[model samples]
Target: MEPEAKWNGSTEQVEFSRMSPRSQGFTKLPGQKTCEKSVLLFTFVLLISVVLWGTLLFLFLTRFKKIAQDVEKLQESCVYHNDSGIVTIIRRLQVDQWDLKNDVPQLSKAVNKLQEDQTTLKSKASQISQQVDRLQEDGTTFRSQVLNEKNTATQALEKLQEEIEKLWTEFQRANGSVCKNCPKDWQLFQKKCYFFGNEPKTWPQAKFACINLQGRLVSIKNKEEQAFLTQKANKKGSWIGLRDLDMEGEFIWMDGSPLNYSNWSPGEPNNQGQGEDCVAMRANNGRWNDAFCRGQQEGWICEKLATC
Candidate 1:
C-alpha cells in the first residue's frame, strides 16, 4: 500500500509506498530517524519535570497550614494561664488593702490616748512645781522669825545678868551697914548669927516666935553653918527653917529660898502620919526629919545675918 501526503499552510506532504524501494530507502535515512527519536524523548522529560514540581508545591502548602493551626492553639493556652495568674494577684492585693483600712481607726485611738496622758502628766508637774515654790517661801519666813526671836532672847538675858549683879552689890552694902555685930546671947559664925530657944513649942508657934525676933528659923547654908547650929542646940532636937508647908515633898526655907544643902538621917522626911510637914534636926546626929506641923513640940533655932 502507498500513503499520501498533503500540504497545509505552505507546508508540503509526500506519500510513500511501503512496497516501493525508493520510499523505503528515504524513510530509512539515519538523520531523519535520529531527529524523531530525540524529539519524543525531550517531550517526555518536560512533562515529568512539570508533574514533580506541582506535587512538591501542593505538599508544602498542606504542611504550612497545619503548622499555623498548632501555633494558634499554643497562643490561646498561654493567654488563658496568664489571665488566671493576674486574677489571683489582684484578689490578694484587694484583701491586704481591706485589712489596712480596718486597722487605721484603732491606731488613731491609741495615739489619742497617749496624747491625753501626756497632757495630764504635764499639768501635774506644773502643780507640784507651784507647791514646792510655796513651801520654800514659808520655810524661809519661819527661819527668819526664829532668828529674830533668838536675837531678842540673847539681848534680854544680857540685861537680866547686869540687873542681878547690881542687886548683889546693893545687898552687900546693906548687910555691912545694918549688921555690925551679933546681939548678946546669940552665937556668931561666918558673918551670920544664930539663937537657940530652950522652951519647947509647936512648929507653927516656933516659926512665929522666930519671926517676932526679927529672924527666920535657922537655914543651914553649908556644912559649916549646919555644924555650928547643931553644936549650939546642946543635945536637943530643934525645928529648922526647912519645911514643905506649901507642897508635899518640897522643903523650902522660911526665908522663901529653896533648901539647897541637906543633912537628912537615914530614911528621913517620910512625912509620917500624913500631917508631918515641918522639918526638924535630930540632936544625936544633927540629921533632919519631917514632923507634924502643930502636933509635935520641939525646941527652935533662929538665924540672922551678922552686923559689920
Candidate 2:
C-alpha cells in the first residue's frame, strides 16, 4: 500500500479521488518491459547451445571413418606377409631333400670299394702265410738230409781205415827187414802200434826196452784201449807209463797228456812206504795199481804212432 500524500495546501494536490492508484503512487512500476527483456535473453542462450553440440557430433564421425580404414589396411598387410613366409619355408625344405638324395649313391659306392679292398688284402695275407709254412717244412727236411749224409760218410771212413791197418800189418810181417811200419808181434789199433812183452822186468828196464823198440812206455788214452790192453795182459800185471815220482802224489802220463781218466784199483795207490810211484796195470780188469819202480818185476807194454 502507498502512503497517502499529504495535502499540505499545495496546488498540485487538487483532487485525490479522481486520479488512478498507480498514477497516484510515489514508486514507478516495472511490468511489461521487464518480462520482454527476460524472454529475449533466454532465446539467445538456447541457440548458442544447439550450435556447439552439432559441431562436436560432425568432428566425431570424421575421426571414426579414418580409424576404420587404417584397421582394414593393417589386416591386409599381415595376410600378405604370412603367405610369403609359408612359400619361402617350403622351397628351402625341398632343396635340402634333393641334395640328400644326390649324395646317397656315392656313399654306398665308397662303402663297396672299401669292402673289396679288404677282401684283396685278406687273400694276399693267406698266400704269404702258406708260402712261409712251406719254406719252414723244406728247411726241416734239408737239415735232416744233411745229418744222414754225415753219418753215412763217417761209417765208410771207419771201415776203410780198419782194412788199411790190416793190410799194413800183413806187409810188415812178410818183409821183416827192420820195417818202417809195426813189427809182427805188435798189435795194431786206431793209428797206433802197441807191444806187450812176455818176460817180467823192473819198471826202469821196461821203460828202456820200449825206448829201444823206437817207442815209449804205454800211456792209456781211453776205455777202449784199456780193454784192448787188458785182453793182452793174460792174468799178469804189466808196467805202463804213468808215475808221480816228480811230485810225490800228482800222477802224469809219459807223453805229457792230461790225466783226464783213471781206472785205479780201489785203495791201490796208497803210496805205501812212499816207494810205490810207478804205475802197474792189473790183468784181471785193466785197473791200475801203483808200485815201487825198482822193486817188483812186471811185464810191460810199449806204444808208438803207426807209420800208415
Candidate 3:
C-alpha cells in the first residue's frame, strides 16, 4: 500500500500543476483587449479616406473640361471679327479707284483742243511768210528798171547838144570858103568834099576800095541829112544811105545802128535771089532801092562830117 500511495501522490502533483488558472492568466492578461480595438479603428479610417479622395478627383476632371470649351468659343468670336474688318477695308479701296477713272475723258478732250489751235496758227504763219517773199522780189525788179531809164535819158541829152554845135559851125562855113577850083564829081560835108565813084565793086570789094581812098561808106543820121545829101548829089542814081547787110531784112545805117525812119522806094528791097547786093538812090523820089551789083548804070555818092 505504501508503494502505491507514493506513485499516486506524484501523479496528483503533475495534474494539479496543469489544472491551475494562475499560469493561463499571466500569458493572456498582457495584450488581448488593446489589440482587438486597434485593429477595428484602423479598418474604419481606411474606408473613409478612399471614399473622400475618389469624390474630389471626379469634381476636378469635370470643371477642367468646361473651362476648355469656354476658351474655344472665345477664340472663334475673335477670328470672325478679324475677317469682317479686312473685307470692309478692301471694299472701300475699290470704290475710291472707280471715282478716279471717271475724270480721264475730260483730261483727254482738253489736250486735243490745245493741239488743234496750234495747227491753225502754223497755217496762217506760212501764208504770211509767202506774201513777204513776193513783195521783196517785186521791190528788187522795180529798182533795176528805174536805173536803166535814168541812163537812157542822160545819153539822149548829150546827143542833142552835139547837133546844135555842128549847125552853128556849118552856117559860118557856108560861102565863107567857097570852092572855086573844086571838081564836079565831089560833094561837100563840113568844109571838105569827097569823091566816091573811083571803082564799081560788090559790098565787100567796095569796102576795101573805100579804105584805099582813106574813106568809109556814107552814113545819114537825121532829116536834115536827107536834104543836104540830095542837094549835094546833083540828081544822080547813086548808091546811098541804108542797107540790110548786117541783120537780114533789118535795115541799118553805116554806123552799126538801126534806122528808126527809112527812105525806101515803094515795093523795094524785094531781095530777089539774083544778085541784089548793091543799094542805089532814085533821082526823082530821093529814096533807096536794091539793085544788081554788076549793073554799071548807077553810080555812088559819099559824104563825111568833121569829128570836131
By lDDT, who's the top model here? 2
Model 1, span 157-208: residue lDDT tens: 6446535644664587777654437788788787677888878888888878
lDDT tens digits by residue: candidate 2, 118-192: 999999999999999999899899888988888577546644654575587667757762334567888887658
How big is the positional error of residue 35 in model 2, measured in Å on the Cα after superposition?
99
Candidate 2 wrong stretches, greater than 4 Å: 1-181
Clashing pairs in 2: none
> For all the candidates, what are their Cα RMSDs to the real structure?
26.2, 24.6, 29.4
Off by over 4 Å in 1: 1-180
Q: Across residues 11-58, which tens digit of lDDT does each residue of candidate 3 receive? A: 888887787598757877747788888889888888888888888888
> Of 1 and 3, which scores higher on TM-score?
1
* Local distance difference test, candidate 2: 0.80
Model 3, global lDDT: 0.64
lDDT of each: 0.79, 0.80, 0.64
The prediction achieving the highest TM-score against the true structure is 1
Worst 10 residues of 1 by lDDT: 1-10
lDDT of 3 at 104: 71
